[model samples]
Target chain A: MSEFDLIRKHLTGIGARRDDVVVDLGDDCAVLRVPHGRELAVSIDTLVAGVHFLPDCDAESLGWKSLAVGLSDLAATGAEPAWATLALTLPAADEAWLAAFCRGFAELAAAQDVRLVGGDLTRGPLTISVQVHGFVPAGHALRRAGARPGDLVCVSGALGDAGLALRHLQRGEPLDDYLRRRLERPVPRVELGELLRGLASAAIDLSDGLVADLGHILAASGCAAWVELDRLPLADQVAGVVAGQAAGGADWGLPLASGDDYELCFTLPPEHAAELSVLAAAARCPITRIGEVVPGSGLRLLTSDGHPWAGTVAGYDHFHG
Target chain B: MSEFDLIRKHLTGIGARRDDVVVDLGDDCAVLRVPHGRELAVSIDTLVAGVHFLPDCDAESLGWKSLAVGLSDLAATGAEPAWATLALTLPAADEAWLAAFCRGFAELAAAQDVRLVGGDLTRGPLTISVQVHGFVPAGHALRRAGARPGDLVCVSGALGDAGLALRHLQRGEPLDDYLRRRLERPVPRVELGELLRGLASAAIDLSDGLVADLGHILAASGCAAWVELDRLPLADQVAGVVAGQAAGGADWGLPLASGDDYELCFTLPPEHAAELSVLAAAARCPITRIGEVVPGSGLRLLTSDGHPWAGTVAGYDHFHG
Candidate 1:
């Protein structure tokens, strides 16, 4: 099929239709109107086969994950996503694969009310680049450099599930269906992020593990933090794995350093922390207080007994890792 | 180097800095305040090694072309360029190559006053995906579906130089320096595009050859066109090559069907067409009147004597060509 035919047949008319999208798909440029009194938040992410995902992974899951990754960044900024542009590179035009991929993409895009505006498709080794645009109320964007000392550090949703799932998949070990789902289908914390807008002092989505992502907040905010290791909300399977390991073993690092969590690690003042129950209910997710920001630099891990916990902590580096 | 380190050392602190940028690189998402009374124009284009470009081409040229391709889309819409996000997938982190690439990217970005806002870097076979965001006055953005039957067809700048350059490179033949520069550094008609906003009836950038790109405008506008083939504004080298060939030879196909011209093809009413000299002077580029839009379907070509001229005119399609 010609490039235009391929787009018309498989990739068009499959996403949310928003009135704000003045011009979409068929045009050279998609013209969109950002609402009055709102600022535009934009982010882009790229996923490559065999590096970001297994080369033989299901096309549908890859599609969902590709957009999810970009949405996660917007979520961190408390932006309500409105549009996305996808640049897809493939070895060939596989009709069945394209159909499944579009189905997966449309599902999440529909939920978030984001329109697929414009994109480019080319022939190459499989790679997907998604750029998401969203809107946030003026002066209300959640940033990583706003945290202050004595504030409370919190996280939404359980951590380490996706990373542990990757471990099992790599080993070819049988894993529970929940772990499989966590690995392939991550949910961006969109509602939680919007809820945190005025309340949270600093926020970031956990992609490169808790220790690493939290470190970013601390570095940007110029403050230290102490995470109570036992307070971490690990996935059920991840908790079991931790229990099976010796204290301070390398496995203890799973919840701290394994990447792809897609959870929000945020900080809020002590007064706002008291309203966690109300905020969690509104977000439809559990919000947990796991640590506190301090007047120093770098992140410190503390055990239940309040002693520093020593374990390997490294963020995922696409180039050197 | 770590992924974060690579970005910090090579990709940060370059490009234009605009007052609208509320939060830029190092944030989860870049936040920008779009001026009131404007609409956002976004477009994405991907260049994969060995597909959109030569795998071993100069890194600086590749970087410039990468951003140029996406900016060309914005130019077609008569949008003022604002922000750009680059998703770069590289086989490895070669510092020297990266520095050169960033230099090229920054050159065009600074000239257009476009800021490098947010992006992702990943490990994979070389691929560059650039998503550009620009702004146009609400209701003033140029589109491809507004042409009327009586409008005059026009194009900014010469054609076929880039295509001929590619042909010479592919065959290891000697080519002029001008052709080489045209192939390496295509100037997107940003000024000309904005100048035609209120005057042009329809607009599109020449990427997939004149025949194909113009076909898009015709299909969308539900009109046909008749081109006086001899009136086409061919580049000096392209004209010389045409002179060296027989009548209706493949060389004629070069100027008609070879892609990668990144020039603006537009339509305007006869009254507006009369002001071409003024527009050209303001745009600082040659504006040639090549044809006229007409009722019916598909494009018709005529020689200087009004005889039908038929030659192969297939557009460049990555999947099929």
Candidate 2:
């Protein structure tokens, strides 16, 4: 069958609302009416083969990772996941590959209740470009510019597992099954974002390492942050990796600078920390208080002994080596 | 300078309003709070080098065309253009190319009052992906499914110049100055679409050829259409090309199926035709009634003598040869 036929037969069965979509698949353009009283939050992310993932990566993981990356944006801003459009470039329209991709994509999209509204399938080297849209009430969404000088910084879940997974894959080290799973499927904290709405003074997602990403919030809000390095909640698996490698000086480097965590990093006034703890307990997710925003210009890391610990900044840059 | 530096310097100049954009460009996500009572219209388009444009095509035109292609989607839904995010992939960060692209992008964006909100820059073969967001009053946006059997099919602006321009470049045919300009610069019918909002029963953008693109409306609305071949609005320069290539046949196949016109194709009741004509006159763009929806399936094209005209479908298809 042709690609168009394949799309109609297999991919279009994801149960998107036909009535809400003015134009669905198989059109020059897709027309959708935003429902009344909702503002649209939009984001786009492109994952290239060899750059974003390995050549031997499973199609299911790729589809899951593609949506997870885009959804992480919505999660960071406390926007409810709504619609997604995919632009797929492939070497050829291999039916098996397409089926696996659609299966994985549909599974994740269904879990988040995100509708697969429209997309483009083209001929080229393998690449997945996903644009996700979410809706938030006017003035109710979280932002990076709202943090004040005395706000406490917090992160959802443990950090460094994803970065360590990448390192393990690169070094040809045998990864424990847990670390491998974390790398293949990083969960986006969507529900936690919604719970943090009206609570987080400012927020961002950990796509680039925490320090670099938090530096964005600091720069935008014109405040500095002081992170207690010893207080960081590293994954047990990551700690095991560090212990196995026998690197004793500092294992926090990869977790702090390595990216692709897809977790929420946010801030709240110190007064709200108690309330936030209750909220985190209800959500069943661990919220780590990593630092506090201060009136200054750069991020400072504090050692357990109360001295400043200088570390190298090592986040992913597309154009930089 | 690297692409990241160029974005930090030039592209970031598109100001972000803290009130409107919850999370601005510097963060992992940009949050937009949708105002109450407004629906968000979203669309995405990707233009790849050697596929969407010639490798040596002017960088400025590439920028303009990329935005135009995406904005055309907004026009089809009768949405007011608001903001845009771009994903640019380059083989290398060339300073001159980046400057030209930013100039062209900013020029069109400023003219439309569309904010350059957020985007990603990456390393790869040159590709320009733009996802545009627009707003329309809740439930008031035009759609392709609303066309009734008796609705008149209308199109805004002239057709076939982009395709003819490509042919001229390919065959080394000397293009008149007007035709060259038309090919290089496509004027999207944004204003005309606004005028059509309450008038058009259903609408679509002419990116694919009229027959294929219009077929979308027919299929969705469960109606057939009969178009008069003589009524197609071909540019004067395109007429000259047709005259020169008389051996190609009387049907003017280039205008019939050559894509990239970016005109608005809409359907309206016969009673609204006069008001549409007035609106088109005020906008200084021609509105031509090329076809009428009928009670059946499939599209039929008739010559002045009312006979079927056989022309090949010359519009673009990614999977087809």
Candidate 3:
């Protein structure tokens, strides 16, 4: 059978609401109607093998990671997940691999109420690209330019677990279930973002390490941040790893600069901190106030002693040594 | 500098309208507002190094072709082009190459009034994936399942020129300026599709070979079609290429199944044929009535003598020998 036939027969079973989707899987394009009063938020992320993930990574994890990464972007914008289009490139159409991958992808997508709208499947070295769309009310979406100089910088959940998970995976260390699951399925704080939409000032997702990703908010808002290194919400497992390490001082840089946290980092005025605490309690999610935005142009890390904490600023750079 | 820095410094200046774009480049996601009465049309296309085009294809042409392919989908839905996000993966970030690619990308984007909303630049084998979003009036978008039996099948401009252009490029054939230009720059019938929005029953862009791509309409609409081979609209240069071939028999199939035409193929009711002709004339584009939909399930090709013409299907397929 031809490629078109294969896709029509085997891959078109992914469910999407047929009512609002005028054109579905087999068409050249999918036509969707955004209800009035809603704005569309779209994001695209491409995960290349040996770069974004391990070449030998499980196909199921790869599929889950693909959707998770894209959904993280929607979470950052406080947009409700709606539709997604996947573009998959593989060396060949292995039916077994495709089935496993689709199963994982469908599970995650269904959990988030995201529909698989349409996409292209082709032959190449394994690469997965997903473009996710979300809907947000007009004038209600969060942005990175709304933060003020005196706003408190906050992050959702513990950091450095995903980075440390990578190191564990690389070192072939048998991670405890908590660390392994954190790496495999990092939950994006989508609901928390919605709760904080009108409350938070600037917001961004931590994908390229806390320092670099948070730098985006500072740059966009034309402000600087003073982060208290001691106050970072580190994962218990990561803290255990840090304590067990030999005197390589401040190896916690990975937790600080490691990408793939998929956590939301935002800013709120000092006066809103109490309300934020109440909101976090209601949501049952940890919301950490790590620092405050200041009037400047660059990020500064402060030690508990009120001195600058100088550590390696290295992070994932797409095209560099 | 890294790819991220290069994009921040250079590739970001692609005429992005940042005022209305809630989240522009350098963010996890970009957010934009859809006007009240407009429905969003989204499409994606991925071009791999050796699969979609020649290995050494001009960077500018690659960029233009990538955007053009995605726009063709929007055009088929009669959506007014609005925004595009490009994900570019390169083995290495070459400054000159990126400059040329951005120039070509921005040129076409500006022509269609499509804003460069957001995207990512990553490190991997050369792959350019573009996701485009457009807007159409609510309940006015065209679709592939809207074709009814007895509708007149029509196509815009000529077909098979792009396929032949690729063949010539592969054979290293010395061609006139027109054929070479056809291969490099395909003019998608965006305006013609917009004009046919309310008139055409079912519409699709001819990206794959005419026979195969049109088959999508037939399958979706549950209709059969009888295409008159003699009435096909062929470019003058394509005709010359056919005449130059020693045996026209095999070459005739190239135009039918060779994809990458990027023209609009649509169905219109017989009662609207004359109106469509007038509309096509007003749009300054030729609309050829090459077939008619029938109450059946298979496509048939008829010669002037009314005999079935059996030919090879030559369009690009991801998996098939």
Candidate 4:
């Protein structure tokens, strides 16, 4: 089959069907009708083999992760998933590989009710770029520049599991299935993001770990934050590893600096803190209050006993790391 | 510098700025207020080194062609350009190359009044993916499915010049400056596309040559077309190349079957034929009527003697070719 036929076979008649999409595939451009009183949110992300993923990584997981990460950006803005355009480059036309990849991509797209509106398939080194478009009510989108001095810093679900899984995989060590899944398939907090639309003061998705991702919030909001390392939520396996460390000298690098958590790190006013449990229940995800926004300009880490804690914290940089 | 630092240094404070952009760079997602009654037009294109262009292609021209082809998609749909997101992957962070690329990109963006809203920079084989968003009045966008029998098939500007330039470049032969620029920096006919919105019945951009690209409209419209070979508009250099061929046996392969010529091919009804000159004058692009839509299922080429012509015609396919 031609590349065009391969794309149509694997991509069409799978994702969500929406009325707002005036034109889908098979056109020079896809046409979308943005509902009145709604603003559109757009973001694009690209993943390259041997850089973003292992060269021999599973095609199914790669496809899921590609769309999931782009959706995470929409989640950060509290935008409802609407449509996505994919630009896929492959070394060759492998029918079995394309079928498997499309299955994984379609699964998440169906669950999220997002439609695939357009795509370009070309020949090159394996690279996947997904651009997602979402909708948010006028004047109601969450931003990264609204955090204030006295708000609570919160995160959803556990952290560091994905980082730990990557380390073990790199070392060729066996790991628990949960950790493996965490690294292979991350669930973006779309529901929780929408719930925070009017309540959370500021929001960002945790792709580059808490310290680094939250630093973006601080820089944009012109404020500082302090995170109590003891308050970080950890999975049971991760907690056991932390417990084995020497008392009060444990390294928090995995949770603080490792990437690919795909959770939400947001700030909320003290008065709205009462709604945390409701938001968590609605989203079906755990919510943890890990820290608080402060008055200054840099991130401050506090030890369990309330002493200022300092340790090297850095995030992944694709080019200069 | 860090990857984030490199992106900000090269991307910010450039391109068109508009009030509809609620959030731009440094945000998880760029939010835009789509004007009421306008449908969003979205398309994406990916250019890989050695596949779309030479591996050693000039960075500035690469940048121009990268975005121009995507805008050609918008032009095919009669959409007004608005915002763009760029996802760039490179082997390394070269400042000089990045600056030159940005200059070409910014120049076209400013000329088209398109805003640079978001971007991603990463490390990998050199690849550039540009997703452009535009606006078209509801129900007014041109499509490839409205052609009917008796419609006049038309094209904007001359064909085959870019293909000729590519041929010379691949053979390392001397070429005229005009032909060289045509291959390196072919202009997208965005203005002519918007002008054809209501006047044309079916439209498409000529990226994959006239025969193959026009085949798309035939398949979509469920009709056929007949082209008179003698009426084809050719640049002087291309005409000379054809003239030197043996009489009555000259190959039309370059004009009929080559790619990378970003021109428009549309069909107009007899009622609107009078407006062709007006559109050409307004868009400042030469218009030529070369064929007519007919009630058959496949393309029919006519020789100068008005007899059926038979020849081999095939367009570029990334995977199979």
Candidate 5:
């Protein structure tokens, strides 16, 4: 019944041995030998018990989502994954819960080859704070400010599934495997990001939905976008979930406003679009052409027929939610 | 009450700009131009309310201590101060609380010259997780495994003040500003650590008392230590606080067992002892010789008269406490 016991049992020995890791989990600080000519990319994300997920959510899923959230940031910046640190706060050290959580976290860590260098454990309300670090060659990191007016907007995967899953779960609607998977274990597109290193002009991960996140890109890049509503790759079971609701069939706008997709939303020059398709096929990850960048500001939703479309499309806001 | 509003009002525009920071606070991930030929030192520490600190502790103090906790890790590794990301969790958004907290955090951040590159804000029981990143030359960072036999053990600054402050506060005794400052704003010895780069063989921060923290270095280094109890630098005013206690006056054991005194404990080759005095004077961080490394294992506390001293000196344990 101590922090040391909890960490030693569950966290230690999880890091894969690497010479670059001069000091590992048990040290006051972990020393990592950054590659000689690469820049470091860093991000932090925190998930609370009830606020970020259901209090009754599975520990394995929570563990997966925690690191995935931070890794998604690396994907947005086109950085190759390197290492991660996790700060876990809990109400109590239940052995089963700790084991399950570590199992889920270790799987992802091994797959990504991200060494678990150092972290902290504490007693408190359930919270997971993960900070991930990666590297990219100098002067080649993707940026939100790099989008040009003639770029084509692309998305890596289906949107609105996680958000739709949340709504369905809250409303007592049964969820299929795909819907639940999207909500519980959304994938981070790190490989796809690496492939887009020179191809993508700008990129961002879709955590706060398309409108809000894409709006961020527009604001940062100082340009506008025209997203064709028909082009959105909606989740398969999402339409069924909406059909069962009182709001009628296939809420087309839902895909644009939903969050937690963790998919990459990026822009590329039209000339590079062909190269992206080849890369996308090689990655075996779906890449849909959702929109195009244009002059001026603001995210504009357009109809399939090239006319302006007006519909409420806003993303989740953490404080408001 | 949106997340964007909360962050824009309290967190954005707060980054201390630097040439190495390619992307700062507003991006999905912060990009740093890692100095060529330098390795990265990383660490994470989380402070939970009612565990790491009193629930009603001053927000200003909490903010300063939050970052200090992580910076202390960097000091233990002899890494030069660089950048940090803060994950702040709270039950509610009170403007006054946020403002006071940021004030304390910003002052220390400016003094250390570490940029506030990125972070996360969430709703939960109050907790602060800070991840700090710094730089050291390849293979030059201090490690707990390097304490060889015949090394002189040293500590930076005084100990037991924070422990005394906590004891007084818990016991409902009259409090003084000095003790409270020691508890709230204990300075991390980053500059002194950089000064000890090639001199100190092993280093660790005193977060969990001299006995427990020093034991870690001993265990890792495969060497034993004999600490001269009389040499421990206790607070000037702590004697008065202990005198007022009913059990005893100036309990010498408090400094050995009491935690939260964020001072650096390190070991050096005996030859470098003279050099440390000059470095200590230049850094304005007092260095005290309290012990020596021996061939055997385990920490042996000694009386001033060269006799074996036996005393109960276990530190704070998260689960047991």
Candidate 6:
């Protein structure tokens, strides 16, 4: 077992240092020179032991997902990932846990080419808070308020995998490798966000399920949406496991109400909507058009053939949990 | 009881908005436009219940001090306070606790003219993490690695009061108004730091006591410091409480090793050191000379008459605690 400050040795070697980092770790604050003409995009996310993840979740995956959550916010803003700071609180410091945690956190930081400039480690009930700072060109950040009535709603990558994975974990059922990986290590669509900067009118990361998250876009843009339920890109397991397992099994609701997907849900005008296919091919990730923005309030779900649909599932609520 | 997320209803009205805050809270990420020619100074600090503060400490005080800790880092770097984010984890959402917490936190954010941006809330252990973002001109941040031999060491405001207050709390001794205020609400020296930007060659915020915090400066600048113990400006309670109160009660070691002072300890050439008197007068905060930069490594403590000093006390170590 390891018992010491979590940041002392493990996190020292994580992340890729950048030239803009004037001051790094060991100082009171990290001084960064924001590139000229760039605006800073900042977001903070906290993962608790039982609220956000399983109490007995793997330390490595927890570390990775903590940073991934913050980075996903950056992706939603069309910002280029740059620097991050971690505030980690743990009950005890295990040497093995620290090593695995650092490895998981470092791999993602390296992939994004982001630097871990500073952080604080303390003793408390396990809670990890990561604040990510990225840079986007002035006036070019993707936002939730810019979608118009004529815009086409789109989502990148499969959606319900992580939510389905949560069902397994909650039911105490053993998760297969594919579902486990999706739940533990969700991808943050940084490149897709960067590519959609000027093309997409609005964007948001899917942390809550599709209906709730997309509802935010609708509320902010003062519009509504007609979502074709069958158009949702569901995970293989979600489609097969819950497709007809029970009466009114919410086959489509898995995507509509499943949270922690970490995918990009965005909207684009009709002229540029077709370009999403080419962009998806280049990114090697699937981007699906699931709905159309309409002039009204709230969202309407429709079946595969465009008939009206209904559901009673709600989005993830920490309070309820 | 406050059951919903803390950020939703309370924090929205806390701080004044800035023009540079293109997009504030209620988004995936807050978009901030950094003015041209300014670099970003970022710092994160977490306060955990029973670790960083008392388990039953006043909720309002906890909130105010959380933001103060991060702003102190900005002060150390001579950055102008601008924006902040909070990630608070709690076991339960009590409205009374939240109202008091927000009141204390908002007052400080308003006084500093710092905008409260985005944040995350979760259920877990009681911990508050605040990340402050400030701005300074490129290459103008006062860093610990800039001190040179023959520079005078200086500190803004009194020290050891907070440490003494901690002792009182730990020993179950009643605290006087002065001592209790010091412990609960630390004033971050943002003005002093900004004033000393071009004047002080190196600087650091005092959190881990004089010897340990200054030791960071010495190590980073590759120089040693000769600290005059008797010259330190100690609070009335710290001197009386620790001086001769017990066997070998030190008249000075309490301030020397006590942490949580949150004062700005900086260095400047002897030529500009005299101007500290004038600067202190204008700023209305005490700036005292307590040491000098020397050519060597580590810190050397001496009495008022310049005799060699000895001590066994170490700075605040989270691990040791």
Best prediction by DockQ: 1
Residue-level error in angstroms, candidate 5, position A86: 0.8
DockQ preference between candidates 2 and 3, better one? 3
On residues B29-114, what C-alpha lDDT tens digit does candidate 2 reach at each position?
56675555666677777777777778898887777777888788888878777788888877787878877887777777877877
lDDT of 1 by residue, A1-321 (tens): 888888878778767989998998889999999999999999999999988888888888888888898899999999999899989998998888988888898888998898899878899999999999899999999999999998999999998998898899899998788887777889999999999999999999999899889999999999999999899998778998888786646366678878888889999999897799999999999889999999999998988899998776788889976
Which sections of candidate 3 miss by over 4 Å?
A: A9-20, B13-20, B243-250
Considering TM-score, which of the candidate structures 3 and 4 is the better prediction for this target? 4
Residue A141, candidate 5: alpha-carbon lDDT: 87
- Candidate 1 lDDT, B16-74, residue by residue in tens: 98999999877899999899999999999999999878878899988888889989999
DockQ of 3: 0.70
Q: What are the per-residue Cα lDDT tens digits for candidate 2 across A270-302?
A: 888888778788767889998999998778988
What's model 4's lDDT at B135?
Answer: 95
Which scores better on lDDT, 2 or 4?
4
For model 5, the stretches where C-alpha displacement exceeds 4 angstroms are A242-253, A305-310, B241-250
lDDT per residue as tens, model 3, B45-146: 888888888889998887788889988998898888888888888888788888888888888888888787777888888888898888788888888888
Tens-place lDDT per residue, model 6, A1-321, is 221235647766579979999988767788898888889999988888888898889988877898899999999999999999988887776668767877888889999998998878876788888999999999999998889989999999988899888888899899999888889988799989898899999999999888888988998899999988778887778887657745864556577777899999999999997698898987668999999999999999987778787556677767664
Worst 10 residues of 6 chain B by lDDT: B1-10
Distance from true position, residue B319, model 1, in Å?
0.4
- For every prediction, compared with the true complex, DockQ reads 0.92, 0.43, 0.70, 0.86, 0.81, 0.64
Best of the candidates, TM-score = 1
Clashes of 3: 0
Evaluated at residue A155, the lDDT of candidate 4 is 96
What is the two-chain DockQ of model 5?
A: 0.81
- What TM-score should be assigned to candidate 3? 0.95
- lDDT by residue (A100-172, candidate 5, tens digit) is 8887787788788888888789888999999999999888888888888999999988888998789888888
Q: Locate the minimum summed-lDDT window of 10 residues in model 5 chain B.
A: B241-250
Stretches off by above 4 angstroms in model 6 are: A1-8, A249-253, B1-6, B246-253
Tens-digit lDDT string for candidate 6 (B158-237)? 88899888988999999899888888999899999888888999999998889888988999899998988778897776
Second chain of candidate 5: TM-score?
0.95
Per-prediction TM-score of chain B? 0.98, 0.94, 0.95, 0.97, 0.95, 0.96
